[model samples]
Target: MGTRKFQGIYQLHYEEAMGKIQTGDLLFCSGSYLVSELIKKASNSFMSHVAFLFEWYDRVLVFESVESMGVRIVPLLHYMTNYKNTGKKYNGGLFIARHEKLIDSYFDQTLLKNMIRTGIDSLNRNYDQTEIIRILTRIKLGVGKHKEDNYEYICSEFVDYCFQQIGVRFPRTMEGFIYPEHIAADSNVYPMFEIVS
Candidate 1:
């Protein structure tokens, strides 16, 4: 309904914007929901969620972990349309970032295949509620240990794990804690585009 931009980032129409997204790009979303609000507050960031993108059988799929649906891959269109279908006023837009160094210097067909396979293998994993709690706790206390287990993962953690499979590492303060803002702010990842519909 209204235009909003951060640091001169422009919002484009969602349908026309899909062409800009490429495989292995990171998507940071400022969702419209109570949980999203809490995440934004706790993380001190505009983005509340993050997902990894890949082209699967000609369809762009986003790999992410959410409390409602653990780790899973869904069509990118589905992700963009979810809030619209709910008939709720959603203000959050989707922001995309790509690892230019990885794409230009390291990415190849085999590595891409391995990344997809690794993401697929992680399907059905549970969302790490404990990690979320820990993050909140850390935010409150201003200090805490970063710990995570393989049993489950949070959104950014899942993305980090997938990239690690292909020998790429995103910035992480600790072994297990990775926030959406961390990935968004990483120097290696270049902001490509944003979409709001």
Candidate 2:
């Protein structure tokens, strides 16, 4: 396999990045929040969160599931300048990544619409707390072969499930748990821009 690099520290203004961003793009962050650190530790990667992008009538929105609020949509500008209505930029590196094959190439309007619709449907769904606990427990205890069924999802898994609507499958390690690092490591995903605080 050819070696690949994570996103660099070079900075780009959020306005410009958002203007150029396409629907079905990705956002990644290395947040310093306590939960974020735990995810980084679990995945052994610097990135703690993964979210998808959606373009809606001159607005760019982020589709994500957070521990505090579960699946929700936030304006792209929320991270660029103020985060969670705070007067400061979000606490970490914000990145825009593109899927080489699926974004503007292989995916058709039908698939794209289906993918986006699935993501929209997940709005207000609770973050999968049970799966997260199992993940952390397995991470610390080294247990394997655990699985269950549920409609709730963590951030990365939520994105993965949405992509499945378009027939794209990401790596699901540890009994179908998809992490932010797993999405980052995808061969088709490449960094396009970054916003450093």
Model 2: how far is 155 from its true place, Å?
0.4
Q: What TM-score against the true fold does each predicted structure earn? A: 0.86, 0.91
On residues 1-197, what C-alpha lDDT tens digit does candidate 2 reach at each position? 11136545457776666667888888988898888888888888878899999899899999999888899999888887778888778888788888775655645878888988888888999988888888887788866543544778888888888888877778767476778888888888888878653
Candidate with maximal lDDT: 2
Q: What TM-score does model 2 achieve against the real structure?
A: 0.91
lDDT at residue 84 of model 2 (Cα atoms) = 85
lDDT of 2: 0.80
Q: Where does candidate 2 have its weakest 10-residue lDDT segment?
A: 1-10
For residue 23, give model 1's deviation from the true position in Å.
1.0
TM-score for candidate 1, please give it: 0.86
**C-alpha local distance difference test of each model:** 0.76, 0.80
lDDT of 2 at 89: 81
